[model samples]
Target: MINLINISKSYGENHAVRSFDLTIETAETTVLIGPSGCGKSTILRTIIGLISPDTGKVNIEGEALSTANLVSLRQKMGYVIQEGGLFPNLSAEGNVFLMARYLGWDKDRIEERIDELCELTKFPKDALNRYPIQISGGQRQRLSLMRALMLDPNILLLDEPLGALDPLIRSELQQDLKEIFSTLGKTVVMVTHDMGEAAFFGDKIVLIKDGQIIQEGNISDLIKTPSNPFVTTFINAQRNHLEIIGDI
Candidate 1:
């Protein structure tokens, strides 16, 4: 459903992504996992058109992304950035419907979509009027997911969607999010540092370092048949944490 061909992005001397090539299958969840500053998030942003690659191309479905079709192609994607990225001034409902309203959706259509999202994300109808700051971190994330899905985009891009929440809340949301993903079956690409989270949500995991993929496969593939030493080291580094939940 999505492809990045020979993509490269650099900032001064630091290379954020380098010759990265990936194909995200339709209706499947692909997780990008790496340490901080390792460029997984950069790849996600590039796919969403927030960062234009200095080399290569981003293809959505079949069309090549260009300045002319950036906006139109972007409408086919739903992006949820870190910490929800909700507008502080807007109520939860407002944030969710922001894009819809901008696209000139009618009041009835907006309200109907809002209700569906609230139920899908398990968000309370009563809290729709609340602002981002007024809600709990988990609720805020749910609202963020709602906002992303409001347009019913074909692809969902999430960067550390649950990173800001406490562990208990994160666990709860993970379960909820897994169910939501299964229910919707949208093509999903997400970035995270946690191996457990990646294993839980990812149908395919791409482990990256220094802006390049060290290994890309299922969790068992990385664990039982590592591509290199770094792949083993990366897994062992999180072994204890992963064992705590018996997730690895």
Candidate 2:
């Protein structure tokens, strides 16, 4: 389990996140949704120790994320970014096995894990030899996911993982991701702007605005009973007009 207590971060005088608190249990998916610049990405960065919180504590399974434990904690978490963040020079197989290799995994074990991840993500076998630039955007994103899962981390953090794909590809990948998560039973935290995507994949949804959580609940509950006008408007904007009824 991951526990975040009063996590906050600032960039110069502007505060990106303030007094944020959240708990992510094992084997569940938590989706964070908000408009642009709402500090959604900041929260992910803080959790991963990529950005230091001005004042707060982050604990993973009761272990504090201090300098001594940060490295170990990071190793136990998988992080996927929007751009895929793949090395241009490396092949898909190379990228997927990078972390395992760093951890001194044997050649046979690394090969087996790479093959398993590619199959899980439905990546083509031939794509393993290709570099990131040679693959399509969707394929790159899938490869990025495969890399993150290579180590079989207990926790997965995805930041707009499907944002770069076209609409059709985006929807397809989203379904694939949902199924993968279900089968793997890994704890997941995803940040997305699309409410429908959040609703479909998240066991719990957290809505944020101006670096603060406005509301949090199951997607069905939020849609049925919005706490305020903003929550109603946000949900309506994502829903088809045919699905929305009454004053929203």
Question: Cα lDDT of all candidates, in order?
Answer: 0.93, 0.90
Q: Candidate 1 has what TM-score? A: 0.96
Clashes of each: 0, 0
Which lDDT tens digits does candidate 2 get at residues 1-248? 88989988888888888899988888999999999988998988888999889999998878889889888889899999999999987888889888888889999999888889888999998989998999999999999999989889999999999988899999899899999999999999999999988999999999998888888899988888888789988887787665666446
> By TM-score, how accurate is candidate 2?
0.95
Worst 10 residues of 1 by lDDT: 239-248
Model 1 scores a C-alpha lDDT of 0.93
Clashing pairs in 1: none
TM-score of each: 0.96, 0.95
RMSD of each: 1.9, 2.0
- Per-residue lDDT tens digits for candidate 1, residues 1-248, read 99999999999999999999999999999999999999999999988899999999999999999999999988899999779999999999989999999999999999999989988999999999998999998999999999989999999999999988998999999999999999999999999999999999999999999999999999999999998999988888887654657873
Candidate 1: Cα lDDT at 29: 97
Q: What is the lDDT, from 0 to 100, of the residue 213 in candidate 2?
A: 87
